[model samples]
Target: MAKAFASAGDMTEKTISFTEVGEGLYAFTAEGDPNSGVIIGDDSVMIVEAQATPRLANKVIDCVRSVTDKPISHVVLTHYHAVRVLGASAFGADQIIMSDKARSMVAERGQEDWDSEFDRFPRLFEGHESIPGLTWPTTTFSGRMSVFLGQRRVDLMQLGRAHTAGDIVIHVPDQNVMFTGDIVEYHSACYCGDGHFGDWGKTLDAIKAYDLDAIAPGRGDALIGREMVNAAIENTRDFVASTYAPAAKVAARGGTLKEAWDAVRAACDPKFADYAIYEHCLPFNVARAFDEAQGIDTPRIWTAERDKAMWAALQG
Candidate 1:
């Protein structure tokens, strides 16, 4: 990801940077906004994640223009989050690739997620009006899919589920680099609202098995060097563990959601106090964790009204 910047609103608080993660592979990361990755192959460019809207997507396009003149032919979405996939039409890519699970998620909950996420984070969806509708992937895969940019092979693998049911990671074996979609967040708040906490840890372990030298995370800067990668992984795991462990403990004690939220806050608030969106994500994270601890496999769909109701019940 070649580095660049664009001033969003003050709520965003920073410009986006297009950092070069590997040769022809870039990560467009905002301060804490949805991160997009770029893979410029031999003949064309493949954007990993589209922004919430075209206005935001164009910023990434502008950065890509600085590096190569190749047209973007594909938009690969790791999951079906509105903040990450809704801007696909703006790229005008001929093909949009996604995992089968991701496609199913869109079919089942895409509309609700679109409405839910828009209400959750308005800044990321700058040009909501420009969106045609729910982003549907033209090319879908089940377990793993390999894309070749001329001779460069980019392996898109559905590692275990963490952030969402359909999470995928783009791996460039030749470059020894991997682009993890929200699987590994650096410094920013972890959105465990719809995550599988137990499976998420396993996914991290699966990612660690790879001898990756560099990684482009879903949020924050591109991580370079082996030690920093280890630290990021550890930090992410710790954050998830702290979140789920406390919530599970409270639930096991027959505590109510309110009590569970408070217990999690007492355990995690001090440790993750400085993380971005701590206040915003805590209530939701606890809710999901509580459900997971109680043997729920799938996350409940989050609607805008449900969001406010949950916040009012838990935080108020």
Candidate 2:
């Protein structure tokens, strides 16, 4: 098993690992920590997600340098999460791309999320000082955007809402490879604090509509074959279901947020107990589910004070 509790200070100097998922595609994973994907074409390269800081992104750049010297023309953000977007400046890509909704989220709450995430997982931030501030996309798209680097076609599609309102998937048709953002995680925990449970399920269904041979998820190891890809998606779907079903059931029966939280904890703890960051994610996931169960659409702001208060009240 991967070590679960690396000291925060240890994060500052940590390097990332590169796993080749396809011919020229790579998944940059750090144990069970958040991951970034890289897709290299005939002429240029497209980075799927930026890491948390410039210092960390340099590690991924080094891996890409080792294999190819193609310029990183585009940095595609899968969503507006702090860890995924803040490190974009380090790439110096000609264009930073994201969905319109994701850009708006950044405008609204990027700083708050930056602060919250750093507080929550200092280990992942590693070289937080290297960040140049909130990373904003230079190019924004609405539904879908398709690009061709020589003959390789890359399709950036907003399948539906999952991990966040603006989640997207990068599909390489010929390679049959897809880079799912936080919409799909493997082995590691899913942070549902800004997720849409019902919409998230629909997004998974849309993902299954693709002809994928492999998948590089937002966390954990990259799925190598069709079977493994499907299993990862199924596991993520089940994880989402298990998280909300109990909370919804209790809410329907007039349970308090505290009661619903307890129910969700009991329901998911057994199944997802061993996943990385489960302890860190459970409280937030339960809180989000509890609110969604009560018909709340948008997730409430998660400031540092709110995080502490919720943890104190929900945790035993």
Candidate 3:
């Protein structure tokens, strides 16, 4: 391999910050690592996304302990990604909720995604052995589901597809705050390996229509205010558009995947080189964009073996 996959060399632990984005709503962000949202309801608590492993989940639990002693009664997974769902078992929440499409994705390619992600970024899976098996949602719904943690109403919605086919967002009506899983990221590269590029902007428009007060994005810092939230949403929009345009152009010209890679790098690197996971997500993003431009709707499953093959092909 010309160089190790980006995550292979990123063994340095990140400093975790627990920032309160809204009243009793918090965002547990670790530098550029995946973020988890905490919604402290009237009686119990609702966790937005589970970390990659039980050990990482425990860290989020500790952050929850600092703020409220409310037991976690619900865990809402925004999508079926391993980093977001595998740690669900550790939460022991009575209700493990996911969108119906998300649960189906879990059945379709859950194990493969777990294997692929683990191999790509082992650092995220600190206690891999502790993961009993693939995480399954106890409850699944389509379109929208309103989950109440006592009197507090947390509306779970499926605006459209962006990060993944099953992507969803957790919205709190009282505070007008939404916990957008990987659908929205701040200062971090959007992982589009399983994404729908054509629908990503539509999804962003859905979230933007809300004009919420705060949003705890999937990664990067918590979006604290209107200006910051809008900026992050648009930034993510720019990232996705910037990544696909050049790759699409290459595909239009019947260029090789390597050529698409070069085009994407030339287009995205100058603007997003300093963003978190920019290099790591580049190849996958480019590959998917190239395929989408050629009319491939569904993203192909990424197994551990395929990850290696893709990385090897993009070594240029």
lDDT by residue (175-199, candidate 1, tens digit) is 9899998999888778888899999
Q: lDDT per residue, candidate 3, 1-316, as tens digits?
A: 5677898789889999999988999999998899999999989999999989999999999999999998999999999999998988888899999999999999999999999999888799877999989999999999998988888898999999999999999999899999999999999999999999999999999999999899999999999889999999999999999999999999999999999999989989899999998889998999899999999999999998888888898885
Q: Candidate 2: lDDT over CA atoms?
A: 0.85
Write candidate 2's Cα lDDT for 179-220 as tens digits: 999888899888899999989889988987885888899989
Q: What ordering of candidates by lDDT runs from best to worst?
A: 3, 1, 2
Looking at model 3, the pairs that clash are none
- Greater TM-score among 1 and 3 belongs to 3
Candidate 1 deviant stretches above 4 angstroms: 1-10
Each model's lDDT: 0.87, 0.85, 0.93
- Each model's RMSD to truth, in Å? 5.0, 3.3, 0.8
The TM-score measured for candidate 2 stands at: 0.94
- The parts of candidate 2 lying over 4 Å away from their true place are 1-15
Poorest lDDT segment (10 consecutive residues) of candidate 1: 1-10
Native-to-model Cα distance after best TM-score fit, residue 48 in candidate 3, in Å: 0.5
lDDT of 3: 0.93
Per-residue lDDT value at 287 in model 3: 86
In terms of TM-score, the best-performing candidate is 3
